[model samples]
Target chain A: MAGGTEIVAHRSGIEKAVAGLILVACAFYCFHALGLNFGSLSNPRSGFMPSVIGVSATVLAAVNLVLTLRKHRMAEADEVALDRYTALNLLMALAGTIAFLVLLDLAGYVVASALYLLFLTKLTRSPGWLVPMAVSIGATGFFYFCFVMLLGVTLP
Target chain B: MENFALLMQGFQASLALHNILAALAGVTLGTLAGVLPGIGISGTIALLLPISFGMEPLTALIMFSGIYYGAMYGGSITSILVNVPGEGASVVTMIEGYQMARRGRAGAALAIAAIGSFVAGTLGVVGITFIAPPLAQVAIAFGPPEYFAIAALGLLVLTNLSGGSALRAVLMMLIGLMLGTVGMDYMTGLVRFGFGVDGLGDGLDFIVIVMGVFGLGEVLARICERQNDVRVTKIKFKDLYPNREETRRSILPIFRGGLIGAIMGLIPGPSGTISTFASYALEKKLSTRREEWGKGAIEGVAGPEAANNAASSFTMIPLLSLGLPFSASAALLLSGFMIHGIQPGPMLVSTEPVLFWGLIASMYIGNLICLILNLPLVGLFASVLRAPMRYLMPVVALVTFTGAYVLNYSLFDLGVLTFFGFLGFFLQMSGYSLAPLALGAFLGPQLEQGLIQTMVLTDGNIWTLMTRPLAGTALWLGVAMIGWMIFRFIRQLLRRSSSQPVAEDV
Candidate 1:
């Protein structure tokens, strides 16, 4: 129970930290926006809307942060177990896509796409490795045929 | 009478062999896509957009319209049978529809939903066919201030009614607006926030951002959660029709839901979802079998499903008449129109009568097709719901990436897509709705252009915007809506504080 509470606290802390990062981003946006020329109201300039948006975003983020913190402070922490296995899989999924994007630029589209699919299918652990492999091959072949052969997408 | 003649011509154009084939293919693919959990109509359309690129404008549009109705049909199947809403609008259906399924009334529930959708969808198309032209005529007289007011109301209404904290929704919208400002300022020809990056100069691609935020974000979110097993009852064709009693119970709800949905559709925000909720609430209040609502009631399934379908069709009004997209799906359709080199607005009716009326006529055909396709194929689509997320998510991710890539073929655009995907996931995790953000991204430029144009015309008198009759009324209504939302939010917060101190879920 103590460990659960600690985990809840940790998650809350992460939330607050992210909220703080939003504030920082808004601040940076405002600062950067100031460099652009802000013309008069009748004749708006490049920075007019950006500056307004940045300030508004900053204020709203601040209010949300305060409300969140107050709510957190007022309540007893109840932990929901974070599914680390799924989380890791999700992370790997993200990594796999990023890798695919890079490899698509380096290797050809088919090779990169097939590899990405194989990796994702293995992670799924569905009917079996063979089925997934066949599915992956089929998916790639279909996409290639439809997009490149038929439509002439000129995919790199 | 002229409109009728034009519509007849449109039907003539649309009934061609190839167009019919395109519509059939679109609805089939759309229904299947909708059956697949987590892939919504917007995401599905975005994924399939590349394929439509080579086709003629009318043919492609007919296909898209088909997909729109078909996807709605597909969503209700999952919501009823599996208790997993395929998209936002079908969430209400899951409540009582799932219960009915559990009670061995899945067939009746599914049939009622399908029939209700067909009726409501056809009614909505009828409304659109008649109402849109006159609305466009009124819109033709609108000035920059009017545009500004309408755009503002659309954004404000969307944010307020997005089923979240108004403050958070507004913040997300502001962020989206800021992101929308990331490219060249067309007024002064000055780049605002590109920061010397070559790719940023042209601005972010709407499709890429949509694919990332909606498509990839949903996939990632699902992947991060533990998978749950879902069971759908095997349904035979003989069990497809509702009994006489069930049909009798459903009639009033379907009509009432359709009316409510059509009315809600005229306003922006999450109209489809909002209409379903409104229908459910109204039906529950008026139902003789009110006690049977959460347990399982024909009215419950009938009303919301009808409302959702009706709203989905009529929500295209603002887009067709006023050149404003009220929702993300409308925004995608707007992008589609643009891709075809056709601007959809008041001028659309006159300038491109064929495209305009053809698209409208296609809706009627599409609804009929959905009814025909869904009735027998609900079983097949229900089977699709059982596909593992592990296999599904990866394909979804690939489609999103490829869709984003095909838009501009820029690596920098890919980076923007990835950034927005991560940002969208985090924002959703924090309980912020994405609809407002997408709306802001869509309406931001229109709002800015209107403001600037109004200012130029009025010589800096912002007060003049409030002087125009229609524009002023809309602007004031938007303000009042926001004020009411803020007040309600405060009251809810106070009540929560006074009652039970709850942990911040984020």
Candidate 2:
């Protein structure tokens, strides 16, 4: 029960943080949209729709953040603990994808994709290195044949 | 008689050798997508949109239609066998279907679902054949005000019905609309939020955002969970038939559910999922053996499965006739159509009668193909569940990367994909629905165009714009929907506050 409470508290914290981030995004969007041409309603310009949407979103996000804070207060702020395993797994996958992007520029599609798959398969705790290696290489080859050879898609 | 002749012409076109092969490949891939838990119909269609660039528009559309309904058939397999629904529509089936699986009546449940899907799906095609032409005729009269009203109503109804906090759904939708404004303004040709990036000149690609959110985001979410082997229920070939009593019981429910779905599908919301739940409730009420519902009633499996398939077929009417997508999957299908340089709307019937009628005709063939494929191949499809996630997720991630890169060969698009992927993951985690976001992005331009055109036509008098009959009714409906959401929201807050003191005291 205590562990469950802690998890809920941690989730509440994350929710509040997300709400805050969205609110900030909405603000930035509004500011950026305002800088563009705000043509009159009779003949609305490019920025008109964005400005309207940004303002509405900013208001809604603010309300969401307030509601989240109120809910957090109502819950009495139990002990906060993160799900480290899930977090770490998500981080690894994201980092690996970003690394793939960089490597695709530095190396090439073949090497970057193969390494990305290898890293992800291992991260998923495939039985051993051999299986991950085989799966990654085999899958990369299939993708290459399908995309490049058959579909005539050029890959860098 | 003219419609009949046109439909016959459609049959002739769809029966061509290549179209048949296209339909075959589509259903097969669609089934695979439905069986796989990680990716869904939206992701699959989005992935294939780029690949379909080279095919004839008719062939690509035929294939997409096959995938659309084939997925409905395939989703039931996982729900019944492994107790995990492959998609949202199959969730209802998992209840009694999984229970039936536990009782070793899995074969009967599977057989009934396939039969029901085929019957309802065919019925939906017949409905579309007669109804969509007239609907398109009526839609041709719609002007800017009406279009704006319909689009606003769609966004409102979807966010209201998208199964979360209405505020969160609206927020996601607004954000999507903002994203839609990032590229060139069609009316003015001015880039609103380009941030000096050359890639923003054409605007954010819809397929790229969809791939990131649905494909890569789903993979990220799945890999974060602990990998566990799924236990699939085994069935012999001989056990595949439903017995006499079960077969008789399912017939009425199948028809009843099909009618319910055909009607619901016309509404602008998640009709596929909603219709299944509605059918289940209706069947529960109508069943004499109500006690068997939660336990392994064959009717429970038959009705919802039929309803979802029927709903999937009927949902295409709006997309085909009005060029508006009410659901996420339909939106993706609309994107597929646009990618092939085919715009589906009122003029489509007159301008591209062959493609329109051919696609409709292909649905009939596709539904028949799904029925034939699902029955004998259930075992093979069920085997897909046994494939470990460790091997599958990496492959999915790689495909997403490759597909995104191939779209424009732009590395900037890949960056956009990754950004949206992460954004989608976090937003989903925070309890925001992505359907409205996708739908909003898709509809944003249409909505803005309609509003601008109407304003200019009415000389900036928004009231005159609202006074038009069809537009007025649609706008009123949107307002009523908003009022209902607010009422529900306040009631929930009040209930929560009332309950809080009791919890504290306890």
**TM-scores for all predictions:** 0.95, 0.96
Best by TM-score: 2
B285-402 per-residue lDDT for model 2 (tens digits): 9989987889989889999989988888898898888999998889999988887899999889989999899989999999988888779988988888888987887787788888
Interface Cα RMSD per model, in Å? 2.5, 3.8
Candidate 2's DockQ is 0.48
Model 1 misplacement above 4 A = A1-14, A79-81, B485-506
lDDT of 2 at B145: 93
For B1-506, candidate 1 gives per-residue lDDT tens digits of 99999999999999999999889888888888787776777777776676676788999899988888888888888888888888889899999999999898898888899899999999999999999999999999998899999898889888878876788788878877877887888798887777799998988877777777877787777765655666878888889889999999999999999999999998888899989999999999998877788899889889999999889889988889988999888898888778878799999999999989999989888888888888888888888767777677667666767667777768777788887887777766666788888878877878888887888788888787788899889988987987897798788777876887666432
Give the runs in model 2 whose Cα sits over 4 Å from its true position. A1-9, A76-82, B494-506
- The lDDT of each candidate is 0.82, 0.85
User: CA lDDT of B265 in candidate 2?
Assistant: 88
Candidate 2 global TM-score: 0.96
